[model samples]
Target chain A: ADAAAGRAKAVQCQACHGLDGISKLPDAPNLAGQNEDYLVKALHDFKTGERKNELMSTVVKPLSDADIANLAAFYHSLKP
Target chain B: ADAAAGRAKAVQCQACHGLDGISKLPDAPNLAGQNEDYLVKALHDFKTGERKNELMSTVVKPLSDADIANLAAFYHSLKP
Candidate 1:
């Protein structure tokens, strides 16, 4: 829930989704200013195999609930 | 940016993204409560082929700027 903590956890996500959440890859949706709840749900879906993207599935597999929440918070705090 | 007009225009979107913006299909991201600017940008990206997804590209090809804005407003107005 802490934005600062989320920032720290966001390093892993910076390659595809930029540090500012503006998506470096065209295939990756920009995360900046996205709804926190939606981001959390999306991450959970990716982790659970409900939403299947090869890269997302692999990336989210190691994330815990707290990590997912932090990542969502970090992304949602940005300006689009 | 009329949410009412957007609601009417959303009939086309209802199949994959539900009438309320929750996704009916697993591959579709939920649009409810998403940032309006982000949604507009996403639609443009799909239209321009900057982002490539067969279905999205086809869906957005016929949408005008006003239609995109209205759709964004309507979806952003929803609860996540």
Candidate 2:
């Protein structure tokens, strides 16, 4: 995954997740330095209703598989 | 809430959560700069099984309300 491209796609996430991949909102979780596989799976779960977070579900609804991968890569590249 | 005391009690959380309140594990969420109320409620939910995370439930089972409050206070004091 191209982390630079992922970073560009991560703009929308900055409201709750900081540009640095740390969370700005209490309800959100920080993504920086998290495992790439975990992040991808979590996003997939949110999109599929396997994980039950309304906000996360809503946010992930529009993402494609590539988008999820890129996002995971981008966030994982950051410091925890 | 004695944040200093809370910091001392947070030793157990450092395995998955860094001493700085950032998460070292993928499944764990960063607690720094999170809202106190949200953190407290999340912990309460974990303890009560309202939130269904096995690891969190196990960790929170032994926490007293005071412990939860103190931990929340300590983590909330850090940068996000």
Candidate 3:
């Protein structure tokens, strides 16, 4: 899917991060307006063994290139 | 594409997040072993307008469902 499409698909994450992409939960971090390069990498790190976060790793480990791009797009589009 | 593929694609995030999904940088976070639902939410939060992180929102605003899933998969795989 296109990143725009991915952005549209990312509705489930609203609880902690908020509808606007900010972290309402202290456990969560602000993702809005972060670097696309870093975002992509972070998502990837979670998937790969290189990163150690269990929840994030499992969540991201299954992502594809299209998925990564779309995620990057969705975050990039937000106002922060 | 599969989230596994997406997981493969997210290598760049290693800088701040570290290869282990743990955030060595104060500005960054520890994605490792985070909740899959929550991880997905954080990424989406960045992309959408509900959450408000400048860098993250811009980075994720483009993600697709595949992207979100892939990211979630990767994060979930981690040990935290």
Candidate 4:
């Protein structure tokens, strides 16, 4: 999985999650310095229906395992 | 907006995003250290349809303006 591709993928996430992943919106959580294990679990939870958000599950469902890995790596690569 | 309350709200975001908003998962992101202004814009984008994420919009739509502010503050209060 390419980190660059993951960065590109984050464009869609910029709205609520922001370009850095940490949200500035009220109630929205920041993603900038979160734990990687936590992120993977969350993504997996969304995709696997463990989580209860319809929209998130939809977004994550389409992502391949490789895509998820890349995304995770992209975020983790930054300084927290 | 109460930063402490906002921190509580972020519990759901712990995974993938991590507790501090930096992801440890491969390909995820570090939300702990981003621009506050950027974060605010991202959340607004999601809630307002300026962005194209179904999940994020859904998640952000449920929050009030105050809630967003609090959440943003919580993340911003951290060492990003």
Instruction: Calculate each model's fnat, 2 decimals.
Output: 0.00, 0.15, 0.00, 0.15
A1-80, model 3: which lDDT tens digit per residue? 36567666566556766656677775665566555666776677666654455666666666787788788668756665
Once fitted onto the true fold, the runs of candidate 1 whose alpha carbons sit more than 4 angstroms away are A1-8, A11-80
The C-alpha lDDT values of all candidates are 0.83, 0.82, 0.65, 0.67
Chain B TM-scores per candidate, in order, are 0.97, 0.93, 0.82, 0.79
* Residue B59 shift from truth in candidate 4, angstroms: 25
Number of clashes found in candidate 2 = 0
Best by lDDT: 1
Q: How are the candidates ranked when ordered by DockQ, highest leading?
A: 2, 4, 1, 3
State the lDDT of candidate 3 residue by residue for B1-80, as single tens digits. 35466567467566767656767665575666555667777676566654555676766767787888787778657655
How should the candidates be ordered by lDDT, best one leading? 1, 2, 4, 3
The TM-score of predicted model 3 comes to: 0.47
TM-score of 4: 0.52
Off by over 4 Å in 3: B1-80
Candidate 3 residue B27 Cα shift, in angstroms, is: 13
Best by TM-score: 2
True contacts kept of 4: 0.15
Candidate 1, position A18, lDDT: 88
Tens-digit lDDT track for model 1 on B14-75? 99889988778655767776677768887887888765667888989889999999998999
Residue-level lDDT of model 2, residues A36-77, one tens digit each, is 877888788789876667687898999989999999899988
CAPRI class assigned to model 2: acceptable
Question: Which regions of candidate 2 deviate over 4 angstroms?
Answer: A20-26, A29-38, B22-38, B78-80
Q: Compose the digit string of candidate 4's lDDT tens values, residues A21-73.
A: 65646545566545555567668867877554656777887888877877766
